[model samples]
Every structure is written in structure tokens, then in C-alpha cells.
Target: MKKTVFITGASSGFGKETVRLFHEKGWNVAATMRSPEKEGELAALDGVLVTRLDVTDEGSIAAAVKAAVGAFGGIDVLVNNAGYGALGALEAASDAEIRRQMEVNLFGLIAVTKAMLPHMRERRAGVIINVSSVGGRVTFPFTSLYHATKFAVEGLTESLQYELNPLGIRTKIIEPGGYRTEFAGRSMSAIGAGGIDAYRQPWDKMVEVLAGWPMSGNIREVADAIFEAATDGTEKLRYPVGQDAEQLLAGRVQMDDVAFKKMMVGQIGI
Candidate 1:
């Protein structure tokens, strides 16, 4: 029997790519997105169910999980990839945006994972892959709120392993570096005039620095890493994708907070 993998934010980016990769490998895929009606490619594939799922909405999460389990027997892997970055000066972010950042990136992920745990526990086998960012382990300018959520994900996933492992459920976190996905484009949000203007100079500088950096258009590497995390059958808790992520994490391990700050200033020009 083919294993079933349920992914959030499958409308695009790593989630969409992962859906395709898993289907290519003959797995049943529950490609859940907020707007299933708008889905195109994955909706047309065999063994792929494009369903409505808004991670921040508990009802939708439950419904999506139910639909996936009903369609594919049971879920063997759950990939939490539905999240976005709310970028601006920390003080400039409105309460709503701050709450939203946490809601979707942190709480929403937990809700979905919680919804699936009972079934996985009963079966005594499953993999839960949370898509965090290199930001989760490190930090940068104007993304304090985004970093907060990701950092929370890192901590939550780490702690989850202690509980989930005893029940044969593997909890893994994927930290991706700069990838040319919607994350850097459409999915990214920049607070406008509502935000403090004093930070614009630094924000613009950061943007220019990023524009000079090499971008990885192929998100397949992240998808492959997610695949490995799910099927490798190891109890490993973290998988950092891309050289940028690996390098940053290495620097984090080797350098002190002061050194890391200096490195960030030089690299980000912030």
C-alpha cells in the first residue's frame, strides 16, 4: 500500500513541489491549501486530493485532515508548510499583524499537528515535518515578528520529539535558507505607511543586499529534504536545507552572539 502524505500550503512553493515529488514516488498526497477551488495542477493528478485547509482555522484543519484520512486510509506524513512572513520594524507592526503572524506560523501549525496526533499515535507510526526557516534559528532586520514565530516552531518541534518519540511518531523541523519561492515575493508582506518610516532606510538597504545575493529558484531541494525527513525512518529532529542555511547554522554554532551580530551587520548591511 502506498503511504499517504498530507501537506499544508500546497497551492505553491515547497508545498506544491513536494506534492508533485511524492506523487511521482507513488504516494497518496493530501495537498491542502486555503483555496482548494483555485488549485490547478495538483487537482488534476491521480492520488492527489486538493482540499481546503486554513491552518489558522480549526474547523478547516479538522475537515482537511478528515478528508485526507478518508480518501487515503491514513496519513503517514504531515508537512506543516502553511505560513508567511510579516516584515517591518517590530514597533511598526500593528497588533493584528503581530497576532496574525503568530496565528498562522505558530498556532496554526500546532493546531494542525494536534489534530493529527491522535490518529498517528493510535497507529504507532508517523512523521510530522514542520517547515521553519533559517530565520527560526537566526535573526535579521525588520523580520522580528516572523522570526518570533519560527523560533517558537523550532522550540515546539524540539519539545514535541520528547513526547511523540515514545509513541513512534517522529517530529522533524526543516529550516530552509533563501529559496526563490513566494516567500521572497508574493507571500511576503511589508507594512506600508502604517509602519514607522524611520526604518525605511535600513529596510531598503537590506532589500538591496538581498537583491545581490544568489537566489535558488529550485525549491525541489526543500521538497526532497521533506521527503527524506518523512520516509528516512530516522528519529532525527532537524534538517536544514540549502548551503545558505547550513552555513548560517554552522556560524551560529561556532560564533558567539556578539560575533554573529557583527557578521549580520556586515552581511545584511543593517
Candidate 2:
């Protein structure tokens, strides 16, 4: 029997690519998004069920899960990829913006996981792939809120892995860096209630750095990582995708705090 995977944020980026790859691999895919109508390409694919799912809304989450289970018999994999980047200095961020970031990136992931855990628990065999970022493990300027949310996800996934491993459920975190996707465009937001002048040099430099970076890693890398996390039974809890992610992880571990910060700031201007 073909395994079924339910993926959130399937309208674009890693989620959409994962849906395509998994469907090609003969898996039944539940490709979910905030607006299913916007996912016409994925919805038209064979064996792909595109459904409306807003992770922040409990009712929508429940409905999507039910629809997914109904369409594919059961969900063998759950991919949590519905999140956005909240970019700005922590002190400059509004309360509402901060809340929104946490809601979609951290609490929303927790909500979806809780909704799907029962199904996986009953089956005693399932994979929960949380789409985090290199930010989860480290921080950068103007992305403190975004980093906070991913950091929370890292902790959440790590703890969940320990709790679920005994129950035959697998939890994995994919921490990718500088992936060429709509994430840098559609999924990024600037906080504060003013123009870019407030942040001045740092903001412009950060934007320039991000814009100039090589868009080498594509969605396939992240999709492949997700596939491996779902299929591989290795004891490794975190899969750092892309060269940037690997280098950043290594640097943080090997370098002293001051040197690491200096290196990161110099490399990325963040």
C-alpha cells in the first residue's frame, strides 16, 4: 500500500516541492494551504488532495486532517511547513507582530502536531517532519522574532522525539539555509510601523546581503531531506540541509561565542 503524507504550506516552497516529489514516488499526498484554490497545480495532480488548512485555526486544522484521512485512508507522514519570517529588531517589533510570528511558526506547529499525534499514535508507525531553519539553531540581526519561533520549534521537536520514539513515532527537524524559494519573498515580513529609515544601515545591509547570496539550494534539497527523515530510521534527530546550514552549525559548535558572532555578522551582514 502506498503511504500517505499530509503536508502544510503546500502552496509553495519546500511544501509544494515535497508534495510533487512524494506524489512522484507513489505516495498519496494531502497538500494543504491557507487557500486551496491557490494551489491549482498541486490540486490537479493525480493522487494529490489539496485542502484548505490554516494552522493557526484549530477548526481548519481538524477539518484538513479529517479530509486527508478520508482521502488517503490514513496519514503516514505529517510535514509541518506552514510558517513565515518575522524580520525586525526585537525591541522594534510590535506586540501584534510578535504574536503573529509565534502563532504561525511555533504555536501553530504545536497545534497541528497535537491534531495529528493521535492518528500516528494509533498506527504506531509515522513520521513528523518539522520544517525548521538554520535560524532555529542560531540567531541573526533583524530576525530575532523569526529565530525565536524556530528555536521554539527546535526545542519542541527535540522533546517530542524523545516522547514519541518509544511509541514508534518518529520526529525530525529539517534545518535548511539559503534555499532558493518563495520563502525569501512571500513568507518574509518586516515588523515596526514605519519605513526602512528607522533601521538605516543595518536593515539595508541585511537586505543587500540576503539579495546577493547564492540561491544555490533549491526546494529539492529540502524535499529530499524531508523524504529521508520520513523513510530513514536512523537515530539522528536533526537533518541540516544545504551547505550554509552545515557550515553554520559547525561554526557555532567549534568557534568561541565572540568569534562565531563576528564570523556570522561578517558573512551575512546580519
Candidate 3:
């Protein structure tokens, strides 16, 4: 039987690429996004069902899940790739921004996982791949809110590994470093940043360094990692992609907190 994969954020970037890769590999794909009507290419693909799935909305989540299951029979894999980074100073962030960040990144992922758990548990099989960032494990100058949500994703996936393993469902986290994605544009929740004077210098420095950073990593690397996580059948919990992610995460382990912060501050030219 052909396996089915339900993916969130399928309208663009990593999500869009993943949808194409899976369809090309002969798997049924539930290519979900907030505006499925706006998507044309993925909808035109063979064995692909383009549906609307807004992670922050529970009603939309349930409906999307129902639609996927109804079309594909049952989802063999669930990719929670529907989140954006809320970049900038913590103090500069409004209350709505804070809550919205959590709502979409952390809470929405949890809710979608909950909706899928029943079906997976019933069958005693499934793979859950969460698209967390390298920022989840390491901090930078102006990513306080993004770090908060991603950090939660790291812990939540780790904990789910323990609880879900015995039930036969596998959970994996894909931590990609800076890539040439919509991350700097549309996927950025707060593009207009910096109102606080205190954080201005460091924030500006971070922005400059981040801009200089290469967008050389093929976004397809992330999709390949996700596919491996779903099919590799390994007990691994975390897969960090790109040279940036590998280096920073490795440094995170080798150095102590103070040293790590100093390295980061130096790199960001703070």
C-alpha cells in the first residue's frame, strides 16, 4: 500500500519542497497551508491533496486532519512545519506578539499532535517530524521569543519520544540553520523591528551578521532529513541540518554557558 504523509505549511519554503519530494517518491501527500486556494503547483501534482490548515486555529486543524484522513485513509507521517520566527527585542514585543508566537509555534504544534495521536496510537504506528530551528538549542541577540517557542518544541518532542515510543509512534525533530527560505521574508512574524534603545546596538549587530551569513544550504537538505526521519526507522530524536546548525550546536555542547554566550556575542559583533 502507498504510504501517506500529512504536511503543514505546504504553501512555501521547506513545506513546499517537502510536498514535491514526497509526491515524486510515490507517497500520497496532504499538502496543507492557510490558503490552499492560493497554491497552484502542489495542487496540480499527482496524488497530492492541497488543503487549508491554519495551525493556530483548532477548528482548522481538526478539519484538515479529517480531510487528510478521509482522502488518504490514514496519515503515515505528520510533519509539523507550520511556524515562523518572531525576531527582535523581547521588551519591544507587544503582548499580542508574545502570545501569537506561542500560539502558532508551540501551542499549535501541540494541538495538531494531539489531534493525530489518537489515530497513530490506534494503529500503533506513525512518524511525527517537527521543523524546529537550531535556535531551539542556542540563543542569539534578538531572538528571545523565537527561542522560547523553539526551545519548548525541543523539550516537547524529546518528552513525546519517551511516551510515544512504546505505543509505536516515532517522533523526530528537524533543526535547520539559516537557509534560503521565506524565513527572512514572509515567514518572519515581526519584520519591522527595534523600538527599544537599550537593545539597539546589539540588535543592529546581530542583524548585520545574520545578513552576511550564507544562504547556501539547499532547502532540500531539510526535506531530505525529514524524509529520512520518517523512513530511516531509527530511534534518533534530533537531526540538525546545515553547517551553521552543526557548528553552533556542537559548540553549544563543548563550551559552558558563559563561554557560549561570549562566542555568540563576539560572532554577532555585540
Highest lDDT against the true fold, candidate: 1
How many collisions between residues are there in candidate 3?
Answer: 0
lDDT of 1 by residue, 185-270 (tens): 76788863344577778888877876787878879999999999998988888899999999999999999999999999998876
The C-alpha RMSD in Å for every predicted model, in order, reads 1.2, 1.6, 1.2
lDDT tens readout by residue for model 2, 1-270: 999999999998899999999998999999999988766788788999999999889999999999999988999999999999977667777789889999999999999999999999999988999999999998787888899899999999999878898988989999998878877788988763236466777777787887798766567988999999989877578999889889889989999999988998888754
Question: In model 3, where do residues sit more than 4 Å from their true spots?
Answer: 191-194
Candidate 1, position 171, lDDT = 93
* Candidate 3 C-alpha lDDT tens digits along 1-270: 999999999999999999988998899999989999999998888899999999988999999999999998999999999999888888888899999999999999999999999999999999999999999999887788999999999999999989999999999999999899888888887633457777777777777887898875589999999999999999999999999899999999999999999988777677
What stretches of model 1 exceed 4 Å from their correct place?
A: 192-197
Candidate 1 lowest-lDDT run of ten: 191-200
What are the runs in model 2 whose C-alpha is more than 4 Å off? 192-198, 268-270
Q: Residue 181 error for model 2, in Å?
A: 1.0
User: Against the correct fold, how does model 1 do in TM-score?
Assistant: 0.97
lDDT of each: 0.91, 0.88, 0.91
Model 1 clash number: 0
